[model samples]
Target chain A: MLKSAKMVMERARELAAKRRPVVAIAGAEDDDVLRAVSEAVRAGIVGATLVGQEVRIHALLEELGEDRNSFEIVNAENPKAVIALSVELCSSGRAQILMKGKVSTPDLMKAVLSPRAGLKVGKLLSHCAVLEATGYHKLLSITDGGVLSNPDFNDKLAIVENAVHVSRVIGVAEPKVGLLGVMNEPDPDFPSTIEAAAVARSCYVKGMTKYIEGPLTMGTIFRQMPEGATWKSDVVGDADILVAHSIEEANIAVKALINLRGAIFMGVITGAKVPLSLVSRADPPENKLASLALAAVISGASK
Target chain B: MTFQELQTRAQHIRPARMDVVGATPFEISIIEKWEKRGWKVRYREGELEHCLQAAVDAAACGETDLLFCSGADNLKLIRFLDRAVSRDYKPLTMLQGFEVPSYPKVLWVGFTPMARYDSIPDAIKGVSVVAKSMAELGEPEARIALLSCVELISPGVHSTIWEATLAHMSQRGQFGKARVDGPLAFDLAVSPQAVSNKGFKSEIHGQADVVIPPDLNSFCTLTDEIHLTGPHTAVGIVVGGPCPIALPPHRDERHMTLSLQVASLLV
Candidate 1:
């Protein structure tokens, strides 16, 4: 299992030494996007292919003091064509990783999920936001924070499966997953709590994950657990993944750690033909690079 | 007023009758402690629902000024209290007062265990009760934040739209002497440094006296995370009824003392 987020960066570098993954940046006209992607290429983790207005990409790379010869530039004048060519590169094995640059999430997702020229597989797409909190020993992943707003039973199971895939990509062979809720036991009054319990139990029966348990709270998953508990207290304080009850619940917890605990953050959208790094504009450069590295590692390993 | 100041003020109010339901030794001692402070206290012993019925009936009828109740079923207590009080009073919302060791003033939070607000109207009603309670607590112009995970108002995220609309409404003096703003995150709502660092202009610059989470799940996750990992005290009560209902934040009776002390005078 990966000890920390830094190890993911190191592993990506090692993978690049053997076979570097080619990352295609869609809408690569933004300055922040070029800066972050170039940093990953400079660190020898991934090769670069810029797909956007070629003139703008060249100007940005030049302003950032980067060599133009390092990247294979594709000219797509409009947003539609830019995203299409980027997804096509991944679909045709020309690139293994797809990184979103300076494009709205909905716009980029449209091309990535196109029917004929898309990267979508049968599995549903879900987001996994991995964090390295200041005081924690290992990395923890919170799922469906950016996608799947109000997930039903099957959606949650798929979300967990997607997060498990990301966990394994970071070297964790078997990750303990916790379905979080307000109570550890299913309360009929709270239907979401019952849903969490049902999902956790189904995963356990199918042996879908290493250790799956819930209707657990954040106190059990990430913080302290109550004493004398009967229901699967084994995942307490050692859970590798926390499957949130809703998107808002996951987003709130994710931001709380970032704002309060000073957590190092990186996110990925999985269950696709290839992993996607939907790097946020609000994220710092290091956080954006971390996402790129994670995507590069997952994409490189999948090949 | 801070919780200490609120408690100090409660001690000086004219002695009033209090009805305690499901009184254990711990709850009884809490009542006895208040009784020694020149307040009239009474304990009713029986089944939880029965005592809650009797206490709610008495408080709703002005036979008592404060009702001290405890039970494992928080929803049951709320439903019974609402049904009995709604005959003569409007429905209520629960507001909690927290005095963290590092915080500057009492953080007033509005939330519900059973109330899930997904629309703008439901959300406004929730904040209205908590804001009204803050007005009752000597903060006529309280700064209230409609808390969310992000500050930007996105059409896709329902909570942010509701919060932004409510924040815009606050400009017309809709809340009456209160400055309400949000879609503020936890950090921007509470940390002045975060507000300054983000460089976003807001009505409440991280000195919010009140914060209303968008839903029950966020409420539970955020509050429980803070309570478990931090050293602090909390006092809570249900407001906008005929009388303020004392609902302690913790299972321990020590926290109930301040809640009872504050609710007694607010009634």
Candidate 2:
């Protein structure tokens, strides 16, 4: 359970202490990425390899009053080539993780999915954003907000499985996954929604997962159980993960929870051989740092 | 229900329009009833199969005043219903419970396969008992309602699973006021003769409004049987989600159209 952001950060620090995961920073065109890299390095959470222009990275590092010699700088062309070279680094075991810098998601994904320099294991690529809420006791993770616009039942399974892996790495032994829907049963006409709930429940029954419940709205999962009835679920009152039906719902829900509910959010891409950090452009410095920290943990546990 | 009488009854509500899909014979008659009342009704077969696309179209085009869905695979169409209700300003509301004026006592009989209510929240159950019991005794129009929780049988020795689940839910206060009874067989539930044959004596023996079927299969089968053979018309609306979807009478195309149209009002 993610009791606090510091708890997960401490866990990441511990994971890094054993053996640091080498992360290659792609599209090193902004100071935010360099600042985050520095934070991760100082915490002993990650070993950074700057893949874009070496001069810019050093200049930023100097401005931040850090020892530039401590970080490994790799001179490369533009953002696109940097992503390609970063993917090359990941493929050759030079780096176990890839962190997006100033490059767009499409450019980063192109290199990650490319045949030559990418790392692919026949699994679909999806994004998982983990949130540490102040109002709640544990860290909550949501998926497919940054990728997979509208995933079907099969795709949802992959998303669930991906989030579950992150949960385990971060110390949630058996994560309770709630398939987000407003109602409990699927409408006969809307097959995709019902299919998603069915798949998650099936996985739970087959012992592939620990907990799965749906036709759940955000209000229901977060709401306290009624006072006098007689029913209980594993995720009642305390949910570790919230699986939305679509990226639209997920994106709105995530932003609302963060901006309105004052939740701390971080993101990582799974289903690939190595984890990839997909930080949003609008994300503040703290969010970027948290994403890098999570990438570090994923890099360590995934091995 | 005759077409004219049902139509007259519908006119009382003065529905804005009607829509139907995968409707049964009875549902079709309901739509015809509404049409006779001068309400526009739209009917389409195999609607559940393409419910998502149809819902998108309905929302985008604004063809009908209200869109109701009635047909096979009601559960499959839940997402579309959710979309239709939420795509606009006035969001649909999914209700968790039904309001019955005549029945003072409600018996929640749980079928072994359905595990949705393992725990009934004490507050809810207490509220139900307190609210209905007091209303029945005090109010001239109020009807006495007794709420009980029961379980239906399952395939194997996961036999006691429902009992345990219900007990847990009750202990945790998941549902409202209702006496929970179960692991009761299907025959004992529907027929008073069967109840006597089993030497059981309970108030809910022959008079139960809502029977919580064990699983989706039992729920579907029992609901269909009630709709097809039972004299009273059956109408179900989905609640307890992001919004409410007014489901048409199952299997009746005409009424299905009307139900979708009714759902459009909430949407």
Candidate 3:
């Protein structure tokens, strides 16, 4: 069972009390970025590395009652340089995990995957978001919002496998995975719909992913799923995760939850040797804090 | 006509050489019997295990010539089988019961449609009824849901038949064996008494194994009518697995014993 976001953050604070989380905040420039950094440092979740403009960071830290002397500030001149230094800090064991600040997600992601500057182990890198639905019983997850668009069936398999790993980390032994689509069963004329159903069936048959449903519509998901029970495929209602058909769909769905469904989303990248936290500007304050804490837990989990 | 011709002419078609994989007591019994007759058989009995791989291995080793399992496992096996078949692995068959195997001509009933019938709890209830009744009679059966005059969509009465069918299937110790087809229009399914009264040689007249009426009311009326109006007999056994989960017939103490005997050969 995945702890609530608040619980995860609290756990991180407890862990940090014993030993500080050495988080390297790359490209720390935005106000939201400063607020998160201040909160993390205040909570002791990060024994901080404030990369990017040093003067502005110190000014912001002083205002938050955080002392500049308590943490190190690296004055990297540009976004690329900051990313390079951040990766170097992580690779060299100076930082336990890399936390994205004001930098664009793709730019930091590129640095992380780059041969010289990033952490790339040569498997698929995917985005997995841990979501807490208001009415649902447990934390659910959805994937590929931060990376990969229009993945073929094999890619979807890898995504599911990757997501399953995150579920295990989040503490679900056999998470019920519902493959999202327009309908549960395919209309033969719609090739994509048919392909989606085929993929769901394939995963079920391969015994690769636990419970799976496909081509499922929203009607069944929000309205019709039997309350308080788990359903496999054909509209697994209020799924732990909403796997999208493409990044476009994923982005739309995630945004909808944030904008419409009122959900708290924490994003991470799996399928790497080390789990990475990739935050966004639009993310609520709680989600940003949760993402960093999750990173710390997953990073220290191995060590 | 030969058996093959008769089989082909039948509206419903099923894949032969059914491979019974997965181990429940039922499947194990099914394999035991088929192997005893010297028919090649392969089985894997474990959690989320692959009988297809074993089946393929058996095929390669010349130990078995056919493979069988409930079509529920089709998607799971299809990809591997597709790869195996593409690599010249011998093509295996998908066994379907009470269906034409192809779409348009066949409609699969039972719990298989639960995914599509989420909104309709009544449909599920109907299946439960069928499963329970059949269980009382002793059968290893999948709950069969009946559709209405509508050809493909499952109606509420399906749950009724399904519960009875499932009971029968389980009692007989088989999983996918009970042949439950239904809601077939009276003209096509049963005596065609209504249609013949209007004069015609019906496609499925007098040959229907199960007839689904429009609603619960119609369903009860028809069952009573069939028994009262004609000399009719029903002997249903769950077929997909080893033991026939069946309700022991009132007249035959031998039926259950015979079912167990056949089940013994399966393992």
| Overall lDDT per candidate, in order of appearance | 0.79, 0.58, 0.52
Candidate No. with top lDDT: 1
> Candidate 1 - CAPRI tier?
acceptable
Scored against the true structure, residue B39 in model 2 reaches a CA lDDT of 74
TM-score of each: 0.85, 0.53, 0.49
Give one digit per residue, the lDDT tens place, for model 3 in B1-267: 111222333223221233455445654564465456554444555433355555545545545434443323233343344334323322221111122211112211122211223234343343443444334334434323233322222333343344344334434544234444433333233323423443433333434323333232222222222222222232222222112222211123333233323222222
Runs in model 2 with CA error above 4 Å?
Answer: A189-192, A225-232, B1-267
lDDT (10s digit) by residue, model 1, range A1-303: 667779889988888999999989998998878888899989899998999999989898899899999999999999888888898999999999988886777888777777786578836889999998766678889888787766789998889989988888887888989888877778887787899989999988877776888888776666666666655466888888988887777876776666544577889999888888886555667788888888988887788
Which candidate has the top score in TM-score? 1
Query: Candidate 1: how large is its RMSD?
Result: 3.7
Sort candidate 2 into its docking category: incorrect
Q: What value does DockQ give for candidate 2?
A: 0.02
Maximum-DockQ candidate: 1
TM-score of chain B of 3: 0.31
State each model's TM-score restricted to chain B. 0.90, 0.46, 0.31
- Please, what are the lDDT tens digits per residue for candidate 2 over residues A48-165? 8888888777788888888887788888877767877888889999999888887777778877887776586635788888988655678888876667754767787778888888
Better-scoring candidate (lDDT), 1 or 3:
1
Chain B TM-score, structure 1: 0.90
Better of 2 and 3 by TM-score: 2
